[model samples]
Target: MTGKSLADYQKEYERIIFFDQPKKDILLAGLKAEMEKQFKLPTRSKEWKNENQKVIAMYRKICITRML
Candidate 1:
């Protein structure tokens, strides 16, 4: 959990959403495509949805930590 509280995560998420608004679509599409390619999951399946959400959440946290 990155040793951070929920509030901290929320704040980071909001900050990123605001500052990265212009490139959000591009970032999301690229992340989704990368996940699809790496996992080879069926796009319409529930598993894909779950994994995608996990990837996005992780990505956001990583961004906050300056890992990406």
Candidate 2:
């Protein structure tokens, strides 16, 4: 994606995280899917990689693991 769009996505991500519109899982999954879907971009751009890693880490912290 272009730098402008990337910046816009980041801004949206921040708003969702702050105001809790997406509730974490949706945002992370959506972002990961978007990142994977756009894998044809040049290898030099690690932006998606960084974003996925961060969101995965955050998910791991709060997500429930064991079935009730």
Candidate 3:
């Protein structure tokens, strides 16, 4: 995804985390799935690999935070 779209998704994720009233589990699951789907893109470039790693780390952090 482009930087703008990624930022948009991050904003939505923050909303779900901080302000959404219901179905947080469902929304988070969907977001995780979407990120996994996007990560299927070939990681041939160093820059792409770095960005993908950052996103995966972010996902993991979200999961841990939700569990806590």
Instruction: Give the candidate number with the greatest TM-score.
Output: 3
| 36 Cα displacement, candidate 2 (Å) | 1.8
lDDT of 2 at 29: 55
Model 1: residue 51 alpha-carbon error in angstroms: 10
Q: What TM-score does each of the candidates earn? A: 0.35, 0.39, 0.60
After superposing candidate 3, which stretches have Cα over 4 Å from the reference? 1-4, 19-22, 41-51
Q: lDDT for model 3, on a 0 to 1 scale? A: 0.65
Highest-lDDT candidate: 3
Query: Per-residue lDDT for 1-68 in model 3, tens only?
Result: 34335666687688778644457766777776676666654346788777677675667765765665
lDDT of 1: 0.51
Go through the candidates in order and give each one's C-alpha lDDT. Answer: 0.51, 0.46, 0.65
Q: Kindly list the per-residue Cα lDDT of model 1 for residues 1-68, writing each as its tens digit.
A: 23444345455455555446557545544544444455453356776667567554655554554443
* lDDT by residue for model 2 (19-44), tens: 34356657655654554455433234
